[model samples]
Target: MTEPVAYSTVWHVVSIAIVFLLGLFFCVLIGRKIGIGFRFSVFLYLYHSFWCLVYFWYAGMHGSDAFAYYNQGLLGIDRIWFGSHAIVIVVSFLTSVFSLSYLGVFLFFNFLGAVGYLFFYSSLRCASIGSKKWVNYLIFSVLLLPSVSFWSSALGKDAISFLAVNLALWSALDFSRRMSLMYLAILLMLVVRPHMAGLLVMSLSVALFFDSRAGTLRKVFLGAVFTLGAVFLVPFALDYAGVKGGANIDSVMDFIDKRQSITKGESSVDISSMSFPVKLLSYAFRPMIFEATSVFGLAASFDNLILMFLFIYGICLGFWRKLNPEYGNIIFIVFYLFGAWAVLALTTTNLGIALRQKWMFSPFLIYLCLSYINQRQLGRLK
Candidate 1:
């Protein structure tokens, strides 16, 4: 006679199987709904799953905030909203309701991240409809970047934030029809990072106000709504982001100084003495091959190299001229991307933090660059 299988082990196995099935189902369903090919969606899901495992291994070897969240979930959470606490609440529900192990939770977040990739791909696919074959290849290359998958595949803020950002981007492609999704994205970002929600609101408000295509009445109505949202959210976001004294220059500078001082580590740099341009450059493209100290850093360095090449390519191709001021979504992306980029560059003193957080804005930058390239290609044909 054999001893009974441990309930914990059995539950872990069952939970993982369920999560995988659900992930596959949703991948196919969403792919069909979004008009992306089924095979490509499956490929994206599997690739993201592979990175999830990599993240799991890295976490086990080096430790991660994910384990803390999972342990807290096992103990249970009292709050269901706001910041990291919200993630803890989600973990609690998943573990308590489904009896999922840590690996299952990782896979679940991987599914969310995969959905984000699908949304991003769908948005780019729409933009690249008449683009050349090379444009498609470039877009595919961006989708396959390992850093985006690895950072977003874990049970942490990055996955949720990536989903929210991509959802917002997808909705922005057809803002009038998909305003609900924009709001949903804002709420998700608000729960995890209020400042980002504020930035989104503020950017959209400015874009709506300047949208030449909209009638004056429509512009006024939507602009007023989003402006009020920004008004309310910006103050709350400022507080949440540790700018206690408010949004004045002094307060902002103090906050930056505080961040630079507090975020000390092996990867930390003294950006306090750096010029604004240098800070932005460092935040977006550092950890170059020579600077990389670990396997992760080396991987990130390669991604940054691609981004650098894309930036130079965009400049050479005059992609900026391709942007139409008439398109409100273009304006919104520009505002949000640069706004987030500058803020993060100034505030994030640690290269490791910069690496994970850069995705918050980098996807938009990629979209803009790709859209411009696609437009250029179509123009050449015309």
Candidate 2:
């Protein structure tokens, strides 16, 4: 009986691989339809596939919450609306119906994620920055980042969130699109992470109201106001209402301080006492080469270094000064990145959690840098 079970598992894996290849082929075709050339699409499919494999191995070697999710799926659905329980039920149902091993489920969602990226890539065509040849390369680089691709290719809420967010962005940004897809994306986000869904809506609303092409002085004032209000006001409001188990402002700050203290021993930097800039840097660029204790950390550090360089380069290129809000994409990215960063920097105490949480916003970060270069070159031509 044990031998039969083992053979069944092996058969399941083999079949899943074949199905994944077929799915990837269809995704490549979709990519081709979206002007992503057959070769590039194939490359992306392969690249995303490779990382999905790595994510699976990493989840098994390291500790992952995927097993808990998987076990929850197996235990049957409870019609519960509380705290990711709905997602567990859906995942459980899918795995059960399809007879998916955890690895198979990982591959499947990663495939969905890859498809979502293609849709995201298509939506970029509507943005001012998407026409440049180098922008293509930069976007491809963002797609391959380990934090974006690897951590998001697993079998947990992160993978699902990544896909849902990408699809949502695509639907929201499409120039002449319908609302159905956007609504679906929002529903998925609500089921998985309602707070993030709210944040996304808030960011979009702010972006819609503040056009970037208005006066630079106006943009600066409004941007600063929005940033400060979001960073301080939302947390206080949530805490005051005791929403989502939130505590008062002091309690929240103390909680973050205590968390930093507790996790300082586990490859974490002590950032509790640091100023806001230092805390943000700790979130964005820590685990530097010298500080990395593992191979994964080293890889992450390299990406951090690249981001640092890009930030410096963008500043030198006057990217921040020349932000064009004529396009809706710029507005959305600006709001999303600032809002996400502000909240994360204030609340995140652990470096690892910081890294994972920030992956949701990395594409926009990369796009902001590339868009600066694109706009600068266009200005020269003008």
Candidate 3:
């Protein structure tokens, strides 16, 4: 039995290399088309790969759900209809078909994230909405974000969700193709995290409604339709989140409070007992420079600080007004970030969950900041 496992492990190593190399080559091709430059794309691929390897290595040594997911796949497609089981079942299928090891499964998901990011950036370029320099900088910054890189480079639902969300953005904005990608994205989110799908639609709808350049009647009609959809959708989403019946504001709040209490005793950091403002602060900006107790914590804190500074600088430079444009892609990002944070802050209790979930919103948050910086530069040039 051990011999069989060891043999499979060797094959898994080979498979990982093949998949990674192929992905790297594909990324280089896509990068050139998107004007990302061969060198930069290669750099990002290597950087993200390093983090992924580190994640897998750490997991292997310390033990993690990687093995659980790998093993679950061996059981052959249980709970296929359940969104949470989707990744596990798919990974199992791939592992069996390819004779993959635990490492192989992890590497494959990392590859998905890397490639997903490429298409995501490509869509932004396709939109032709922001300054090239600014967009490029934001992409680099988001890739460098410790939480974004680490959480998204692992083999888990977070990695898959991250890829799906980015792809959704790309498909929604790219415009070259039909809306198939957008629908696919919605389906993926609904399966994995139903609330996220709701937030995605709500944010996009609200942004469109508020666009000053769109016709009044068009905006009103769109707003009404989206609003009705949300009214029906929210309760369904709440049910999926395990909020019990009716899924109203009060029930959601009750769920949050109950979740906070339940997770408070876990080994992770517990801000459940903190004041609401403090809890929100912790969610948005915690593990401050001085508060960091570990290397990872410090890195996360540094990323948060950098983001906070950029936001402040943009405001001080009077770029906030331009950032909140009446028309353009930035508004979509702004609304999405706002919607995601609102939901995450209220419902999230554990620091670990907060870190991983908030990363889903960082790409847009970073983009908005970069957009402001670009506007400031353009204003100066004028």
TM-score of each: 0.94, 0.79, 0.84
RMSD of each: 3.7, 5.9, 3.9
> Which scores greater on TM-score, model 2 or model 3?
3
For candidate 1, give the lDDT: 0.84
For model 3, the stretches where C-alpha displacement exceeds 4 angstroms are 1-10, 119-142, 169-180, 212-233, 265-267, 317-320, 324-327, 380-382
How does candidate 2 fare on TM-score? Answer: 0.79
TM-score winner between candidates 1 and 3: 1
What is the TM-score of candidate 3? 0.84
Output the number of the TM-score-best candidate.
1
lDDT of 1 by residue, 237-272 (tens): 899889978799999889888988877566555565
Point out the higher-scoring one by TM-score: 1 or 2.
Answer: 1
Span of 10 residues, lowest total lDDT, candidate 3 = 1-10
Clashing pairs in 2: 212-325
Q: List the residue pairs that clash in candidate 1.
A: none
**Model 3, range 82-172, lDDT digits (tens) per residue?**
4568777777788778877666667778877786677656644443355566556665565577676687788777777787777666654
Candidate 2 residues lying further than 4 Å off, grouped into runs, are 1-7, 119-139, 168-181, 211-265, 324-327, 380-382
Of 2 and 3, the candidate ranking higher by lDDT: 3
Model 2, C-alpha of 227: deviation from truth (Å): 18
Q: Evaluate all candidate structures by whole-model CA lDDT and list the values in order.
A: 0.84, 0.65, 0.69
